[model samples]
Target: MYIVNEGPNNAPTRGTLKRRDIDDNTGGTPIIGIPNLHIDEGELMQGGQWITYILHSDGISQLRLVRIDGQEQQTLYCAPANTHIANMQLSYNGQNVVFNQYPNDGGKPSLYLLSLASGSLQLLLHPQNDLAYTPTTWLDNTHILLTSFIPNSGAPRNDLYALDIIQGSNQHDTDLQKLFSQNWSCGSFDVSYDTTKLYVANCDASNGLSATGPTTISVQPSMGGTPQPIAHLNQAVTMLRAVSPTMLLLMVENGSGDTSQNGLWRMNTDGTGLTRLTDDTTGGQSLCPYSQYAWSNVTQDSKLFALQETDPHSADRKLYYGSLDMGTLTPFADIADGTDMRLVGWTLY
Candidate 1:
């Protein structure tokens, strides 16, 4: 598996890439150790042959691609000065990438699509008036799920929409379809692996940006239908993903003073059984302490996942692996001493 260590505490935030052996559970070997490289906004392409990442230096951001073994690196796109690249998602077929570009100072964000083979770029969507669109994930090679919202309006509801890339040409040919029957406010959401159902956590966003109230978990057809309420959580759900058609994994914020309820949780798709997989208890006594989870950090099979947690020996955020069927974790590798890290994605290595 590959991971990116982000130096958030450093003078200028930078990223260090490393690779780990999942089966051995050993420390990671550094792959890239260049100066001023920010890799937090990158992902491994499907089939694990290539990687797409962003590089930042001197207030400029460039989109680049590299082979799996850290060779043949090339710049794919160069953004305008003072702009940043974010929310980059490679297509399922590994031929194209869709991402958002925003100015560092201030302004609304715009979406774009890039062809990896020819290095061609196209403007996909731009915000008009109060309405804005942001790419969330790719449903397939041709369809992408996006969130449509009115920025800074405190409306409490941000809807989901699907963008069909193959249906037409140019900006006018982009087909936007709403995925819900009514105005549904969702905080954390994921679609089933088969793309049949959509699971949503209705967290309170009264403050416009953060989830501050109880959350209700619901399931509905991915296209559009009546939502079926499943589980209700007192703490806000920060992250969640569908492990399968019948199971889900979620992480709730540690706000209720329960050490056992801080890290990771797993439950059924229909909300039958709920289990705690890890906790915030430290001192090397808990299963996983000070853990952090990501939406796309799981393996290809979805049975295993990678997360960052404090290493008891070094006090740095390290990579840990947990199973979908068990709560115990196996120590893998420390990301970078005294720096925060994130699992980019799993590869065939």
Candidate 2:
């Protein structure tokens, strides 16, 4: 995994270890920093054939694709000056990648597709008065589920929309259809591998804000059907991620006070058997929640990867792997200081 350089000596803050291949997993000599680099997002594509990351350098953000083995780094496409790329997704075949680019001067963000072989970039969708920000799971090679948010809204009141890759003579026809509309604020949604079910978390009970005591987890069909409330969490859920068809990883806060005291929890997809994962309950503690967590199912073995903070200021956050069945955790690596690391997933080719 590639990480930005933000340490004491400007060293590249990155380390790699093979758990099954090494006995002393923490013996590697640390590299300091890689200069003039910033990685915003990283994703695994095409069943882990390649990993893609967005890098910001020289005042521009460019998409960089790398082989899963940490070899063959290549620039896929670079955004125009003064524009920012939002969420991105790679097709199942690994031939295409799509992302949203927002102009600095303010306007709607447009979706663009990049061809991996030809190094060509094309505009996929450019909607007026609406901006696409979050890239959800890919429905197919030619379609993706995304979230559209209104500009200047302080709260995250976004609607889910599907974008068709096939373009028409009329621009309006390119925008596909709205999946589901919610009255509350929602973010961080994901779809199942079969593209039939969607899991989304929202605080519909709070008026334009996320507060404790009222959050809903909804399971809805991707084709615009009635949403069934699978679970009504007593505490406000801050983040929700799908581990598989039957399990979800949730970060929640008890509504009585600040949510930092809240830890991690796991539950069935239908909202049954909620289990808390963390025991830390100190208020105003930083747990490095921005880092992404993913579950790995290889050889019928289920494991989870996450960034855990051993310090309050998050200055000593490290990666950890845990067994889902036993709930036992082992430290993987200590991500260097000054760099906020977000682990997407392990690429097993």
Candidate 3:
């Protein structure tokens, strides 16, 4: 099953969620999850004047893009051949799209790029041995920061590498520069707007592949520099986004107790001034960290969008848009029935 939501303010009015069996011989019956929510404004466009995302069928993966209103676009922008497309990010201008493609059968993965204007598809990296996943962010229009995992080693872990897309083609191998090697899995990372520093989440305390201690979020300069720990959380920090050089958005699970009830937190880049945004104490369901949330630029301030699962009665998910104000939160749209809507990626046009 796959779904796509426009954003907090631009949701669809009436659509159907169909679930089809992929292996069925006769093409089985389609199960509808929920109705689609409508948006008053049209779809997003190429320029940095609107916002939009691409929802794929895997239910947990998606690609982000910007498109014009009533464009009647198809799902071929970043389609991975014989693989599942996950973890996508768009360039600042929304012209280039980068994502990770994992083969369905099993093998080392590669990074892919899509030219929205030219409709050209290219593979950026095809590792000889290790498997790559979870591309952090675009350092520039031609370079991307990513993590690769080499299996069977004593300590299987993710290492940071910079992939230069302009150096090679899909038929040939590209150049990959090893930036830093770590003992733990690299969760999420973001590059500064000026491309000077990088903020990353990792379990850097232990020696094994799976570090047992609380995850540490840190920032390092693009040039050689020590990684300074920004915040130490009791639980594992799964996802993070840098709203600016001074602010960060994070999703944290409880370290001591229940892991299902993850909470949303915002804090300064240096780890001071921590603020809790969402509380899941009562009955609020946890949002999908990868596919449910995004931050956008609106003038000087930033806006947040997510598929909020308010309560059990709220049809599983609704598109929500809110301001980045400290104490106040306002909803721009309430999608009554966007159940199958999985956020792939977002672009500010």
Return the TM-score for each candidate structure: 0.82, 0.79, 0.65
Candidate 3 lDDT over 1-349, as tens digits, reads 2133433423433332222222242211222222344211112232424334444342233443323231343444534456666666666556777666777666566777888778787876666644555566567777777666653344444667777767855522336777777644425666765678877777533333322336788899864378999788765565677766577776564433455435567778888887777654423423333421223322234544342345454554443333455424443223455333432223332
Top candidate when judged by lDDT against the true structure: 1
Q: Which ten residues in a row have the lowest lDDT in candidate 3?
A: 25-34
**Model 1 residue 290 CA deviation in Å:** 19
Higher-TM-score candidate of 1 and 2: 1
Per-residue accuracy of model 2 over 57-96 as CA lDDT, tens digit each: 6567788876655567777787889997867777767788
Candidate 1 lDDT, 1-349, residue by residue in tens: 4445455433445566677767665556766656655554667776766777776766678888878677888889888887888778777677888887888865667788998878878888665556666677776678878876565565543678888877533453235788863233435777776777788887754434444447789998887788999999876676677766677877765333343456678889888888877764542222211111122466667677666666556746656778867868876765446665666667666
TM-score of 1: 0.82
Model 3 residue 188 CA deviation (Å) reads 3.0
Q: Score residue 66 of candidate 1 by CA lDDT.
A: 79
Per-model lDDT:
0.67, 0.59, 0.51
Which pairs, if any, clash in model 1?
Answer: none
